[model samples]
Target: MGNIALINRRNFLKGSAIIGSVVVAGGFWRAAENGVFSTGKGPAYTAWETSPNGLDGLVNAALLAANAHNAQPWLFKLGNSSIELKADTGRNLGPVDPYLREMYISLGCALENLIIAAKENGYSPIITYFPDQQDINYIAKIDLTTMKPLHMELYDAIPKRHMNRGPYDTTRDITQEIIVSLMNLNIDNSEVKLFMFDSQQDKLKIGQAMIEATQTLISDKEQIGVDPKWTRQSWQDIEKYKDGITTDAQGLPTLTRMIAKILPPLSPEQNNQFWLNTLKNKHVATAAAFGFVTVRDPQDYLQVVKAGQLWQRLHLWATTKGLGMQIMNQLSERRDREVSLNLTPVFGEKLREILGTSEWHSIIQFRMGYPTIEALPSPRRPVKDVLVSI
Candidate 1:
């Protein structure tokens, strides 16, 4: 293998180019002007800002769904008896998410959580996707005036679903029964397909490829810039820009998080060793299993959003089962349409073949198992923050 130092140096330029584009495009200025950097659920907290029975409350529950970078790239317009979900164009991630695939998936996640909450609170949500051809930002409208609340079991896990990034307890086996339950969650015959890798060999294959993907990611300066933008390095920054990733949310030990609070800000470029070693030491290699969500059409916007919805549902389901999941999908977000990862062409091909969908692209992947301890909750933007003036 090549030297880690050499690899880090090599990819720094590529990553820098992406960051430069974001700066040149004024992503930072726009984010700042729009107060996109702001974080924390202020005052009574967005979850309790409204009752669990109305559009506002439903939107609040949706706000808790996981999103790429925790950017929460969505806005809501409360209607007479429905809610409008729109993309927050102001919260850009530069070149890392060039086509905004992650953004739409994020909207879908919010949409899923909203539906679950709505159903539990006695309102039926009728979804209309891409309601307006002219306005691409108009994702969907949930009309809640027609039906009665049918409490779904997944509702309780809405707020509790989290992405745990720390090491998992390998001894705590995720039994076949639980795996079957998770697999059954693919009740919808959609274009998206979900697969779980439980075998030691499959896990090892993915674990190794993930290590390669991280090397590719760490070398790219643009991706580096993209990360620090959504990562709060200090306690002050965490409370201020309440939406980005923080140490506490990262599955770091309580003491480590405490130390992090007082230490000087850690730069994203200084991420070579940690990123490179994590896969082998903590993720796919040691987790209970690796899971993937693939789509027939990687370029299809609606399909991608639906993938996010499916992810949130499964993630919440995992939460209710007392399991934790960690997403490690750098391979899927590659610019190439094929499964070609940074490692070898054959590696991606193997993943596609194993999933039994040679033509489909893996949209997202994650590691799941029981956590050794409880995880810290990631902060979110208050409901009022995402409300668009209508």
Candidate 2:
């Protein structure tokens, strides 16, 4: 909160004017289809489509959630009247996420999806966190009992919801009604606190801070180097693994997505400028509004997971509202093995001053706006891949 300078309002307005013209002139641009999130049915639910009922389908629905670098670090153990979700420790991000905070939060996103899918498809889900204290890997067990299926828009939105990191319409403002709706979503999850910023000046501050965090991550060879592990380059690799971050998920234009396909995999060391420029556009410059999330304790495992469940609900609700959200979490990534990663301390202090609460630590940050196009959804691993036989 200290020594942060205000941005020039005139420049902000001018840039917004240009983006507004582009969006107004062209409307939501559609890219040539490569079979990701097509216009017809949207992203394929290979996992949920086959069964649509039973444990495998449930896990398949959960798999559709947003995750860390799209790692999808979770597994499902079939249960008679329940489905157990455990951390696939194999998917850990090491020092990049030293405490496995993102991993657990990712699991929470998945769990939220599973619960909604359960109810929509006629199963009543009762979730119990850390069902086995002896096993830290045991995130939660969702007890599924029979119920009369209740049709809901969120069930349809589960597949439709995705991170839109591309350029967005600047002239358009998020209605006060929408902002209030998003803020009120996590009322039941008392541990989660959200701070929303719709003002241009506030957005600039978050953008500047996020840019710093992004620079920090890419500057360190070890951190940026580790990122490639979860980044899929070749179409062959993305198709084979059916997981990890892909070029299409960046919300790039059709030309760029196609150009990316032609090139060989570039190392993060070589792409520092590309990463910086891309994120500046995606995270800072083009976004309409930004917000951050904080929980009671950053280190509490179950709290982190429940926070994620809350996030999933808000995300799906946003989807129903026709708003797109992208999580800018580099501010929360660890600088080393130490808790309260130094990279995020500035944001924490700033949040403390802004939110007027000293009890919460920042967990996730996001930008939401009206997009000019519908980017293809990221791919998911088949249900068989994550289902564990017990």
Candidate 3:
């Protein structure tokens, strides 16, 4: 009887070990399949490497442009010697961008890239904004003419520009010379103005405003709900959609990201809190300088688009300088939300105060500095997916 009992116990223990091993193996398999390890390698990123020429190449470069939420909310209509950039309103963040402000801005980012690529690929591009008054979505039409290939430093930085969400190296300060160079990118643009806040006092003021705005945003249930829809938590979704924010790009440590892949996804509330924490700890804390782009009227879509173009150009220039940049647009977003709801423009007022002027309206805000870690690229929809008929 004792010998039979001992054999049964051994068999049970062996079976349990097998199940544990299978479970552990299964978790790892899922992680690998879901892209817990892969950061920027996929069909989505092929455009960066292919480097095709002419209109097709222009579209490829446009796909790499920086946009809000990684929404990539713009479509291209290619012509023999032209390209039409259209806003994909359907992809707009619902409450987060009620005015379609960010949507138009995103289209502007794509437009900037298209123009840069066109210039680099031996074409002089002429842009006509709002080519069709009836269809606001028809954002811009670029007519291209053959020209000598103009190799620009900004054009070369196209594929290299990724938003760095990680903590910056606070020890390294951006020099005045670099700041002046960045400012020069927008020197000819009269509509959109760039402002920088590098002093400790100024950074603290803007950082506090950002935190307050983030809190306001997360508390709004509708905004919080809509925001998460664009966040791709699984590797399957990341590859499948090829657009939207991913955990790997969130600046979390590698170990934390791996563990997050194995663990259940965070609830919306938890995710909101996590964002708030990250903003306070990783982002705002380490920002060496904060800057914002402003226009005379925030409601002017054209001005907003120009602001985005300025941002893209500035970012590309910054990339060449080996600086990391992240868009800190929560305050601007909250301001949009306020306008949409007809609420008092609390955030708007704060922004104006920070800029120390009521004349210019803040369209976009960002921070830049030397980064402690490399920023990962977010998934992008290939040019093929974004091309539209007619």
Candidate 4:
């Protein structure tokens, strides 16, 4: 009896030990699968938390500006008292942005942030656009002079501003006062105009146009092929590249993001379909309002850049007002593609009809509202990576 009891006790102890080991292994697996070890940590995100003084700090702030596909496509040439902004054309979004319209707008965003940071750092920035007209890539030159530090509310919102791609709170409506304030953001700029669409009818019109444009864009073989190149699937890639869109920034529910991480990487078709579905179900359906930044000429790079600066300032202001915003530039993307291919301007016509204005060309469109979930910051290349020694 004693020997039997001893054998049973040993078996029970062995089973308990095995169960404990399994539990431990499962915990680690879950942690790794969810990217708990990486997500927003690392050199890519350090700029948001730190405030280095001078040119480096300005560059860091510029790095946080909203960009197409999270592609940080601007490089800096720091001078004794000037900072030159240049477009890194190599990072251009292939067929996705054939004309580099979005690219210049992205540089404009960076330029806006740099100017805001300069003011906050006690400098008056004198900006010269296309300092070297001979070099198209030479975007802007900002000559800074000492001044009493002028801190603006928009400057304080720089680090807090993020592109919210998740579903917004439909229950909360943005007020007319807030919308008017947003409209006033571009009142001083005659080249760029801001249009707001808040009525349910207008929202439906814009949402349908955006959905159709997205469908058309994803159907293009070249676009689909090139677009996925900007998506970072693994944590390793996210950290190593520190530039493209990641799962965490997709605005997926926490559990959904975790599940996606555990699964094998999605195929290009799957990714495209997922984007469309999310746009239809989460983004468009839940948006509280739609807005457009229209310019006198879409082909004019300077106007596009100014449009971008307005967008950056608008987004920062929105952030200060505790609002969430995401660019839904699919319609513009489709229009560009049509122009490139000399196809019928189906999307362009739609945009004009929605805006009720042929006088202004739409350069960018975005949705704004209160987000259901907090938006995470996309990874940014550090100042060191972007600085060019001139």
Question: What global local distance difference test value does model 3 have?
Answer: 0.80
- Report the lDDT tens digits of candidate 2 across residue range 1-390: 000111111123344444445446662241222332331222333553444557777777899887888788999988788899999999887767778888888999999999888998889888899988899999988888899997888888887788777678888888888888888887655777777888988888778877877776666566666666776665456667777776667676654444344334454554566667767765578788887777898778978887788788888998888787888777666323224344435545555654567887777778888887685677688777888885
Candidate 3 structure quality by residue, lDDT tens digits, 1-390: 000000001113344444346457775576577665576788756766677755778999998998878888888898888899888888888887888877877888888888998888899999999988898888899999999999999999999898888789989997899888888989545788999989999999999998899888878888777766677777778778887877767665555555555555766666777677778877889999998888887778888888888889999999998899988778888888898889999998999899999988887888889987777777888777989987
Query: Which residue pairs collide, candidate 1?
Result: 11-219, 15-220, 15-221, 15-222, 16-221, 16-222, 39-241, 39-242, 40-242, 122-149
Identify the superior model by lDDT, candidate 1 or candidate 2: 2
Worst 10 residues of 3 by lDDT: 1-10
RMSD of each: 9.2, 7.7, 9.3, 10.1
lDDT of each: 0.70, 0.71, 0.80, 0.82
Instruction: Please identify which of the two predictions, 1 or 3, would achieve the higher TM-score against the true structure.
Output: 3
Error of 1 at 255 (Å): 1.6
* Per-residue alpha-carbon lDDT of candidate 4 for residues 1-390, written as tens digits (9 for 90 to 100): 000000001113344444346447785565574464566778768877887787899999998988888788999999999999999988898887888988988999999999999999999999999888799899999999999999899999998998888899999998999998998888446889999999999999899999899888878888766656677777777777888878778776654555456556666666677777778887899999999999998888989999999999999999998899999888888888899999999998998999898999887899999988888877888889999997
| Per-residue accuracy of model 1 over 5-112 as CA lDDT, tens digit each | 101122233444544465577766643432233322343134533344456678889998888887889999988888999999878666556667778888989999
lDDT of 4: 0.82
The model with the greater lDDT, 1 or 3, is: 3
Which prediction has more favorable lDDT, 3 or 4?
Answer: 4
TM-score sort, best first: 4, 3, 2, 1
Model 2 pairs whose backbones collide: 28-372
